[model samples]
Target: MKKFQVVVKCSLGIHARPAAQIAQACSNLRAAVTLETDHETAQGNNVLEILNLHAAKGATVTVTVDGPDEEEAAQKIQAVFEAMGPKEKKVPVLKVAFFGTKDYDRLY
Candidate 1:
């Protein structure tokens, strides 16, 4: 088994696009791959699992690979994490106050 730790550099963190790309890369490898952060763990080849980790920018995540091609898998998987650059800012959703029909609704 082989592994490496990396910090997320992308501002948006490990969102959909990078997660998909990382998953695809892991899928192409012969080794079984996995990733873990302080908050969560994910199967490296599974986009949904990776996204569920919510590894925010500057967060550290460990990449692990075990199998016939563990070394190469580690190298490539590490690259996927490093490839993501600074995050781009997106428009924020506007939230509004809601009025309730009953006095009890004010608790919200």
Candidate 2:
């Protein structure tokens, strides 16, 4: 399993759109993805489950990817979160830092 933690930079947190995007990122992957907050754990491919995480700004989220395509799946999901940048009018400030991984750096 591949595991990493990130802070939610989006002002509004993981709402419908972000959740949908996260779900979409995992839709075609052969690996299983999961996101976890302090109080809840959610399936990365489930919009409702992601929304249920209720991760607000600055909330730390742990992402886990396992199975056949973990590397590809992880990269895809990371891109989705990275795309939620300052340019995104709907949900600006969305970014993440992959904790403990040399390949990732903090966005903010």
Candidate 3:
């Protein structure tokens, strides 16, 4: 058995997309895994179960994995959580200081 804890940092928290990714990974590994919030524990191999956990931003959860490939599965599970964390927007923030300056900044 292996265990790892991750605190969610996604902007909108843990939603269906990330949950589904976790569930698919767990199912592919054929490992028994569970995701636990403060008071609820849900099977990691099921998308609905993970989504139901309702882990919001800054929430911490522990992932437990038990199987022949427990270590590998645990690592994958941790990666899944890490991948779900909030990422910067692809479009760069353009700042145009045209109020006092004559030249406007170029847009990306």
Candidate 4:
């Protein structure tokens, strides 16, 4: 078994997007991963379980991976959390714009 701690960085916490991403990543690994925060433990590969954690920004979360690939799984899960946004930093929503090109009319 392997365990590591990560801080939540998303502005909205582990909401749908982050939760889904984490779940998918964990699901790809062979280890049994779980996340612990605020005295609550959640299955890392379950979107709903992770979402139920309600881990807000700056909150420290502990992830545990157990099985044959525990070490690699821990590292991968840690990387995912680290690349989420920023440690202890909140992400701001940005507006995006789409530009039309010469082929736009053809597609329309």
Candidate 5:
């Protein structure tokens, strides 16, 4: 068995995309992969379960892989987490100025 920790960096937490990527990483492996956060544990290859973990930003997740391909599975999942790290928010920033006034408003 092998275990490693991953920090959740996605602004939206462990949402669908990361879950899918985690699942895909384990698709061809012969190991049993599981992910555990402070509140929950999930099967690494199951998207729904992975999502269910609700690992928010900055959450530490423990990845555990056991069986014949444990090393490969662990490495692949680690790569996926690294590749899925934090993303820039796409929200538009807005700035407004009032006429004849040194006042401005900003929205993120």
Candidate 6:
């Protein structure tokens, strides 16, 4: 088994999009992959399991690969994490209106 650690830098964390990409990548590989974050461990090929991790941005995650293509799997996953930019705080967009106020307008 081969093990390595990587930090999740995607602004959205390990949400659906990233999880799907990861799962697909793992599915295409021959190695068995596992991802660990906090007390949670997920199969790399399982998108739902990966999403359940809810790995916040900037969290350091451990990736373990075992089987014939361990090295390649590790490298590919590492590259994916590295490609995502550093964690960022997401800004919330809100719209408010005052009752009976004709001048009310949406704020950008």
Best by TM-score: 3
Q: Candidate 1: list runs displaced more than 4 Å.
A: 87-108
- TM-score per candidate, in order? 0.76, 0.78, 0.79, 0.75, 0.78, 0.77
TM-score winner, 3 or 6: 3
lDDT of the candidates, in the order given? 0.88, 0.87, 0.85, 0.86, 0.87, 0.87
CA lDDT of 20 in candidate 2?
95
lDDT of 2 by residue, 18-93 (tens): 8999999899998999999999999988999899999998899999999999899889988887776446347568
Q: Compute the lDDT of residue 101 as modeled in candidate 4.
A: 70
Local accuracy of candidate 4 as per-residue lDDT tens digits, 1-108: 787789998777888988998998899888899899977889988999898898999899988888999878887787778778845657899998666677965575
lDDT of 6 by residue, 14-105 (tens): 98888888898899998999999998999999999998888988898999999998888988888777766664579899997565535454
Q: Give the TM-score of candidate 1.
A: 0.76
How far is each candidate from the true structure, as Cα RMSD in Å?
6.4, 16.9, 6.2, 8.9, 5.4, 5.2
Query: For model 3, what is the C-alpha lDDT against the true structure?
Result: 0.85
Off by over 4 Å in 2: 88-108
lDDT of 2: 0.87
Candidate 4 ranges beyond 4 A from true positions: 86-108
In the predicted model 5, the residue pairs found to clash are none
Give per-residue CA lDDT, model 1, range 1-108, as digits (tens).
887889999989999999999999998888999899888889988999999999999999988889998878888877787789764679899999899988789787
lDDT of 5 at 36: 95
Residue range 7-50, candidate 3, lDDT tens digits:
99887877989988888888888679989999889998888888
* Model 2 vs. true fold: TM: 0.78
Clashing pairs in 4: none
Residues forming the 10-long window of minimal summed lDDT in candidate 6: 99-108
